[model samples]
Structures are given as C-alpha cells and as structure tokens.
Target: MRLALSGVSVRIDSSPIVAECDLTVEDGERVGLVGPNGSGKTSLLRTVYRALDPFAGSVALSGDDVTTLSQREVARRAALVAQDSTPDFDFTVEEVVAMGRGPWLRAFESTTGGGDATITAALERVRLADHRARRLSTLSGGERQRALVARALAQESPLLLLDEPTNHLDVHAALELLELVKDLERATLCVLHDLNLAAAYCDRIYVLHGGRIVADGPPAEVLDPELVRTVFGVTCTHLTHPVTGGLLLAFSPQQPVRSPHSVKG
Candidate 1:
C-alpha cells in the first residue's frame, strides 16, 4: 500500500498548525515523523487519519483520496494508534481489541467465534493475552499504550498511523513495539519522540519545524549533528550502533560551548 500527503495544511480555530507539507510512505515502508514539541507532527498525522481534515492539499491511500471515501472505507484502509485514550466505556482489554473489528462487521452480525480468536491473537502478539480480562481503564499507562496498539493490530489494515506509541512504555515494551512495527509488511507513518528508536526502526525519517518539513531522508542522512543542533537546539554526537548498525544520537541540553579565544586568562 502507499500513503501520500500532498501539500497538506491543517488549521484549528482558523489558524494553521501545519502547512503545505508533502510526505509519503510507500509499500511495506516505515516512515518516522520527528520534531520538537509543538512542531505539528501530530497535526499532520491527524490530517492523514481523518480525525482532522486539511483545508488544503490531499491525503491519499493507495492512490485514492481519503476524503472521497466513506468513513468505513477509510477505516478499512488505515488504522491509527493515537496517543490519547478512546472514550472509556469501562471495557476490558479483550473487548477493546474486538471493537477493532467493527469496520468489517456485516449488518446484523454482531459477534462471531472468529472475531474472538482474532482479538485473542492481537492481545497475544502484544504480550497482553494474560491481561485480556483486565479493565482497559485499569491498565498502567504503558499497558494502555500496548492495548491501543493491539487494537490497531487487530484492525488488519494495510496502512498504519501511530502517534507517540512508546510514550509511556518501559524499555522492553518499547523495543517490543518497535519490533512489531518492523516486522509488519505495511506502509507506516508514525510520530515518534525518541530519535534513537526512530533511527533504529524506521526506514526513513522526516523532520518538521514551524509547521513545515525542514528535513527528511534516511536516518543516517537526516540525523547529522549539524541538523540536530540547529533544528533541535542542542549539541549532538553522531555514531553508528556497533551492534545493530543504526544511527545513535547522543545529545546535550542546550548550552553554550565556550571557545578558547573567548576565554579570559
């Protein structure tokens, strides 16, 4: 599948949050969206997933414009793992995963034995099968994040959109989720805060700044020290991970680097 955002712009309260941005995820490719806080990474995502419509440009899935499709058709084409929780209906984990099948349900066919199996498999894939009976609201923040992912997994869509999926996960869980993303044969556009994780898992990375795409390319090319220092306002040391061979971004909080010539004796 292919996902494309062409010169998309999003606004809230009649003010633009994202502007004229074009991005793409080709078949079986994983793309990362990264930027500083309030840079509008999520705003672009919201446009693609149809939670927010773009006032300009277009979002297309497999060459078909999303705005032209019905809501159910859109859901069948793409699944979103958003940061915030869905409205709480006091559902269990199993129930939450099963709800993902709603888009596929036929009229008057509310439940099925196969649906239950699908839900079980989704939970198991995320290592939450044992917690299936637990209340969705009661899961820890990380666990809830996993449940959200499990819901998207069960949707079985060819296009995946994720926003901050690893926000609250522990190290192991975070890695586990990224591994799942890497293994999936789908077009993925994910919003990620952890640059190292994006470098490790994503095939390409796009950096947004001031609501524009400031930089984009392979992780190795886009994550240079100069770009990191300028766009992120921090110093960085770039190196390859000897074990996995991915880019590792070591950063320092914004601070002045004293020059020898400027130092007084």
Candidate 2:
C-alpha cells in the first residue's frame, strides 16, 4: 500500500502543528521520518495513519483519497504502533493482539479460533509468544513495547506507521525491533530519533523541521553535516562503516570551527 500526503496540514486548538507537508512512500518502501523534538514528525504520521484529519490537503493510500474512506476502512489498510501504550483494563497480551482483527470482523462478531492462531503468530514474530497469556500490566517496559508492536503486526495491514517505536527500549531491544521492521516487506513510515539506525535500515529518509519536510533522499545525501546542524542544531562528523559502506554519525557538543578570515574579533 503506497501512502502519500499532498499539501497536508493540521491544527489543534487553532495552532498549526503540521504545515503543508508533501511526502510519499512506495509499496514495500521503508521510509524514516527524523528531526528535532516537536518538529511535527509524529503529527505528520498521525495524518498518514488517519489518526487526525488534516486541516487542509489530502492523504491517499494507493492513490485513493483516505478522507473518503471510513475509519474502519483506513484501519484495514494501515496499522500503527504509537509512541505510548496505556490500557486501563487488565487485558491479557493475547487478547490485546486479537483486537487487531477488528477490521475483518463482521458487526457484533467475536474472535474465532483462527484469530487466536493469528494472534499467536504475531506474538511469535515479535518474540512475545511466551508472554501471550500474561497481563499487559505485568510486563516490563521493553516487553510492553514489543507487545504493542505485535498487535500492530497482527492487523495484517500492508502499510504500517510507527511513532518512535524504540522510545523505551534498551540499545539491544531497540535494534531488535528496528531489525524486525527492516525485514517487513510492507510500506512503512517510521518516526525515528536515532539517525544511525535510520541510516542503517531505511531505504530513504524525510527530514522534518518546523512542521515541514526540508529534506528527502537517500540517507547519504540527506544526512550531511549541514543538514544535521540545520535540523538538529548539533555538530556532527560523518563516517562510513567499513562493512556496510553506510553513513555513521559521530556527534560532538562543540560547534564547527570557523575559517581564519571569517572569524569575528
């Protein structure tokens, strides 16, 4: 499922959060969204997943305008793993994952035994199979995040939107989750804060700043020192991994050195 945002903008309480953003991801493409905090990366993703309607402009899936589709229809096409997951009830992890089949169910329908099998499969994919019967509240932070991702995978959607899916994960768990995402042959738009991981996994990247997309291309072209400084307000040196030949960012707290004549007295 190809996802596209054309001139998309969103406002909450009369304050604009996402401003006229235009972006696209082809089928089975892994696209990363990255920028500084509060740069509207999440907001833009929310629009793509139909969590919030854009104040102006359109979101399309496979070239069909998503606004014309019902929420259920949109849910059938895309699955989202948000930055946070908070369930008030003490639902078992398996039950939570089964809900991903909601879109396929008839009105007033309940999950079937086949649904249980699917849920089990999803949990296996995220390595949460052992925790299937466990209460969601009893899980650790990383376990909970993995469970949420498992639920999204259970939805069986062609397009997946993940908002900081690695937020609470330790370094190993973070890489494990991203590795899972990389292996998924689905159209994906992921909001990621780790530039190195994004460079390592994503096929292409879109750099958002001040509610707009300022850069889009391969990680090598889009993640240079100038772009890093402009978007993140940080100094960085780029190095190529010997094995992968991909860009690796080495960060520094100090600013770039000025040329002799350009230095002010």
Estimate the TM-score of every prediction.
0.91, 0.92
1-265, model 1: which lDDT tens digit per residue? 8899999999999988999999999988999999999999998998776889998999998899988988888888899988875645988888788878888889876643434777788888888989988898888777777788788888888888999989878898898778877776678999999999989999999999899998989999998888988888988898878997777888888778789999898
Worst 10 residues of 2 by lDDT: 110-119
Candidate 2, residues 1-265, lDDT tens digits: the string is: 8898999999988999988898999999999999999999988888876778899999998888998998888888999998776467888888888878898889988864544777888999988888888999999777788788788888989998989988978998888888888887788999999999899989999999998899999999999999898889888899989888978999877567878999787
Q: In lDDT terms, which candidate is top? A: 2
TM-score of 2: 0.92
Q: Model 2, clash count?
A: 0
